[model samples]
Target: MNSPGVKIHHLDGIKILDLFAGPGGLDVAAHFLGFKSIGIEWDRNACETRYAAGLPTIHADVSVMRESRFAEIPSTVDVLAGGPPCQSFSVAGNGKGRRALETVKKFIHRLVDGEDEARIDEDLRALDDPRTALVLEPLRWLLKAIDTEGRDPYKVIVLEQVPAALPLWEVYAKLLRGGEGRLKGVKYEAECWQLKTEQFGVPQTRTRAVLVARRPGHGAIAPLKATHFPFDLHRGKRNVAQAEMFPAEPATPGGKQRWLSMAEALESASSLENSPVDVSRLRRNGRMEFFVVSNYGSGGDPKNRGQRLSSEPAFTVTGKVSRNKVYKSMAEYEADTSERFTIHESGVLQTFPHNFPWSGNDQAQQVGNAVPPRLGMHVLSWALRGSPPSDDELVAAATWPNTPRTTTAELRDIGCGDQSQCPPGSHKVTRSRRKPAP
Candidate 1:
């Protein structure tokens, strides 16, 4: 049977440098799969989160990092992975409109060479950078630099972002070809696919565009295959070809995807006690309110009730937050029960395992901003099949830490003493455990 986790034998020792690494979700997964990882993140909170998780991190803006510094990167880097900030390309953001497009170009230029000198020069000459054209000049610069140095340092490059980035792929493909006859036999080919996280065994449905590029002479790289759940297929949903499905097993027969509920993501706890939650406000919402806790739900048609959902895979987490509304009688005051989804739940849904810690708001803005670690691991395992090791390899190569050995009461007691302690939905204790008489 196919295992839910990536097979370790496929990924023994690999090294990765994560650029624009927000909160280390991708780095954490690479670590779990036995690859070494070095993260570059500009955000203070994200850098701190990575450090706390025991991962090596660089706190400088990737735009400012010198090209010569790229040489400083370990020689054994097998993969270069990152999710550049995509606000300029996101549908919800102003990127689609004119003003935002300028921001996008500027962002790309900055990514290539810390300063927007080219755009600044253009503005001085033409008064404005055209808004409609996709800006990919920086990527061209980086690729050319790598080729000129005769350093094919990385075997593979995984660039992940919103679906709108499809246009940028063409620009990169041409750049890799390098000035016609100048670099003969140095060819590059790439493939892109729109992937749904839930299709890969996550509970939520999130679709993202993944672009994978390989240098000339490397073997074929396979796109990740979905392990469909039986429940989802019974409702007439799409299924992987029978030939591709993993063999059946006792826990998951017929390669069915595993199902996890919001409760499971929340550690299946009964209540959010001693977490300083406002109980009076919670009680005011009616009986159903107890069961109507905030969770990662579907964004599909509200009218389609019978559609089978695959809870085994997670959905592509986005930056949009959920707004909850409650209906009441004409005589009573209506309550806007729209509490933001907690950051912890969002992190769990993104497949960051139970112990990953996040610091910031308990809203979608923070959680959705993260790359699901489980999905990242799936991709890294594929890339690191054969590569040398580095310091970051220690983390990428480690397995999930052993589960906590403490009991519920002991955990609660520890949490009660510390105000900002315990996972969400856990309670606190008033007294310590009594010692037995000798």
Candidate 2:
């Protein structure tokens, strides 16, 4: 019953301004829920992707945002949604917490206390990774929205980033508090949760530190609880809590958190026409099943890449996901031409609309960097506990513009940025519907 089309909550006409909005994942979610929104992004490819997807966009650097940025928008915005460039603070990146975080905090506290704005500018220039300072830009705008003329108290605030940035959010919650007691009465209370996308029915596993702040008047924003569970490769290999199972129709009854597996997720999109793929003789839900080909080794070699069973959630689909080998096991074992996941398959793994017009040049980076739109739906649902969208709308949003589709043939023999380092059989596809995966 918990299908993609089954909207559990409605945004209820909220206006959203998505900063650093990569490829408009939040915009897609907002549009599906009927929320009025605009996205500002610096990436040209991502902006084109947004435009092609039929979402409104302002292609500009978020750091230079002036008070007049949102002046022309007809309605007052209800939510301030942002995900600043997180690379500088990502644990995966070498720049994690390299003194810039402390500087960022100092800037945030000062800005919250209404200090000399010029000093903050000076500190930004001195930071290690100036990109990290972009995180503070939201606070700058929040301060302006509150102190300057003609702005209303933002009804909600939503933000996300790597887990390393949790401390920044904690400070943000304090600043967001309406005086002191959020339990009693507050304009908004901010809280962050470490969320796993796999737990939200995404075939791939991705964790994001999420923040949601909501003002008084409506019910408190509910903490996002996982709606699905991590699927097990070997059914009896591990005993997981019933709560961790994905709830299915009949097969697994009683609220089991049956996580979607990669095979099931991509089954509809599988095609072995031009490329060689050894489809396993196994069958699930009336379709041929094939094990994923991967470089992952169970021996725990940190240097070597790892693999995930088609029956289990995928590893984090990075910008290099295409380069991650996805093979058809050779019969009971398979692998001649190393199979690669098409852009559409990779995008769907991130829970973007299956046919989302990825109208950009760097398709891999666009899909990898994007906020999974399904994750967006889950987060917003928790933030707005209201009427859900009609199943039709959800389906529409997931499959809209049905063009520039990626196909099995196109993904064959693609090339990565550095062709020499590109994965075997590397293939590339342009954004939009020249081909389709599903």
Candidate 3:
């Protein structure tokens, strides 16, 4: 699996720079994999959470990080990673970016042609959501590494975003592969895939579009293999092809686990004594099962609210996660709202450590925007090691830091910054990337 000039080093020697890092989800995974990591995030709320988790961070905007020839960037960066703001392209938001796909592609080609920054910025400002143009920032950084006189090109690149961004990722894969336009003979092996969170053992049912690329001479790479079945597949509701492709039970010979459930994740053992939540109240009709009643509508109909069972993964956690109600059964839901998931419980569903300190004003947004750390571990292992982490490693990463829980109030007391000072578009977070049902 070794490649010329791209040999895998001891994990300790690898270094990574994460742009738009939202509360260190990938940074936490990089730590578990023994890679040194530093994240640059403009969001103060996320920065506070990172500090509480003991992750290194550079509190600055990604747009500003490219100044002075990337002067503040570490010289030994081996991996380039980021998740740009996705609201413009998300179905949950207005489809400004999606509508402007052709325009974004033109900008990408302009980057390849060495267009000046001012011209590009001026054109980008014309868009409905300028944040949509931020998706190209990773490519800007990547291209700079190759063009700058003294810098060595990054060996690997990984990016994640809402599924609607997959078309954009496909465009990136082409540019990295190299051909007629500007990246002639680059020969990097690159691929993009839409992956479900639950398939990687996350307790939430969400999907993300991911792109992984290796420099020239690195061996070809493929999408990360799923270690668990999806919610529908585990319930035997999927078609024959998917069923045959993945094992049915955790006990099956292939060793694939069934989809992780909300109850299992929230109730799992953790290093912090206060972390293991007592979900007995969620038991339906005295049975050991629970349900989640979403605050949002199903298919845009307010009367048709969405719901999921405890045996299955929870619905995609949103910035409004605290608004969702958990009930013992349909009867309880119809009678009245039972209880809401606490901030800590909400983080648990996202596969964040139980004790992770949630900080700043909008704590719910902080947790919702994070890349699921468990899923991060799998993806990072695939990019750097060309394989998946062992079951033992995954288990160990889940309990990362092994520290006591840091309360949200405590984080605020320590200068997390005034909520009013954060600008309107400063925060960057992804929304649901799953496909719309027929």
Candidate 4:
């Protein structure tokens, strides 16, 4: 039987309020599908980048401007989307997730225990920075909006972060939907899951924890499927149902889905391997390395050596440039990628528009921090009432710096201050006291 061909639909004028929108990656997807969105951002450079990209933005921190600031938008809004900054919770950065988790847990406990909301407010007000806790701002807005409207305030809420934030997101789902049994006063139904970007047609192996909540009568939140199946990455398009029948790998998606490998994406740069290689002189901040010298810097552990194979999706793009080093293996000449990925290449991997007119002072940071418009498209497409976009539409949204579910409170805290519990091969390596230049 032939799978019904996908017919892309117009966005139907759904509006979105994007929080912590960095460089407009999510907004890019919204635009591709013809949706209106207003992004809230505090970073001046990132705001400049968003404006140059033609995305509307409010230049203010979520804490400062607040969601109420945008409640007056002329258009009716249906979705709220954003991925809070991950530095405070990322293993690559100083591990403040533990401290922030405690405070947030206490705050949630108090709120559910019938404590005065004002007193809890005063306690959180005294918090020191509480950067990791910034992720909670979205939930705060969700509650405020639903109560203020006395109905489903928004059709959907989408949030993404590093794996560490999974627990916090689960906690949020519990508080909002009352977890197992829908509480008497809960506002919506919610679910969370972990999604690998490569499976979703992104040419990268970045994994994120995503949570989706919707008011009753809307679809339930479930793990978004990969448009580009893994087996498809190895071969051309095939029947997706067949793949589903023969579960090859442990977590393989059943379908004709094939991943878009790095080679396919960087075909433009295929001939550039002969150019001069820019190898790092010192080794530090990397979680792994190749068999070269100990000083040769890279990001993963000994097994992967941080080499991003052209045959596979790229490693997770990070603010740290040293994480994903390109490894070119030619018939005669094999070495680390000679030149660094151009700003455009990085944008492509992040699934941004080709050479998106970058206006920010920190080009790398802007690119790395985005959610990839392609990835955002899949999310926004499904988020709309009835999940209207066709499968083809969802797949089209995943070409580059593109960008999913719910897991339990499986986040580790004991060794979280270090990378001890990060994914295999992503722990920090202490080298000579000297630091390396980016």
Q: Which prediction has the highest lDDT against the true structure?
A: 3
Error of 3 at 271 (Å): 9.1
- The lDDT values for all models are 0.49, 0.64, 0.76, 0.60
Q: What is the lDDT of residue 347 in candidate 3?
A: 84
Runs off by more than 4 Å, candidate 4: 1-14, 67-75, 109-118, 125-129, 147-152, 179-186, 229-254, 268-305, 322-337, 385-438
Model 3 — which ten-residue stretch has the worst lDDT? 3-12
* Stretches of model 3 off by over 4 angstroms after superposition: 1-14, 179-186, 233-253, 269-272, 284-288, 297-302, 402-438
TM-score of each predicted structure versus truth: 0.60, 0.75, 0.83, 0.68
Query: Which prediction has the highest TM-score against the true structure?
Result: 3
Clashes of 2: 27
Q: Is candidate 1 or candidate 2 better by lDDT?
A: 2
lDDT of 4: 0.60
Candidate 1, residue 232: lDDT: 35
- Model 2 lDDT tens row, 57-81: 5555565444445453334576888
In what order do the candidates fall by TM-score, top score first? 3, 2, 4, 1
What's the TM for model 3?
0.83
Q: Which sequence of candidate numbers ranks them by lDDT, best first?
A: 3, 2, 4, 1
Model 4 compared with the native: what TM-score? 0.68
Residue pairs with backbone overlap in model 3: none
For candidate 3, write residues 1-438 as lDDT tens digits: 222222222222438999899888898888888788877787877887776776656667787767542755667787999889888988777889999988898899898877787898888899988889899999888777776779877888999999999988999998888733444345478999999999999988899999999876657897688988766634355333232454446675656677777767876733346665556566565654766778654665646777677666788888889878777766777788688888878888988877776766789988888888888888989999988977778777656464333422332322223333233555546687999899
Error of 1 at 60 (Å): 1.3
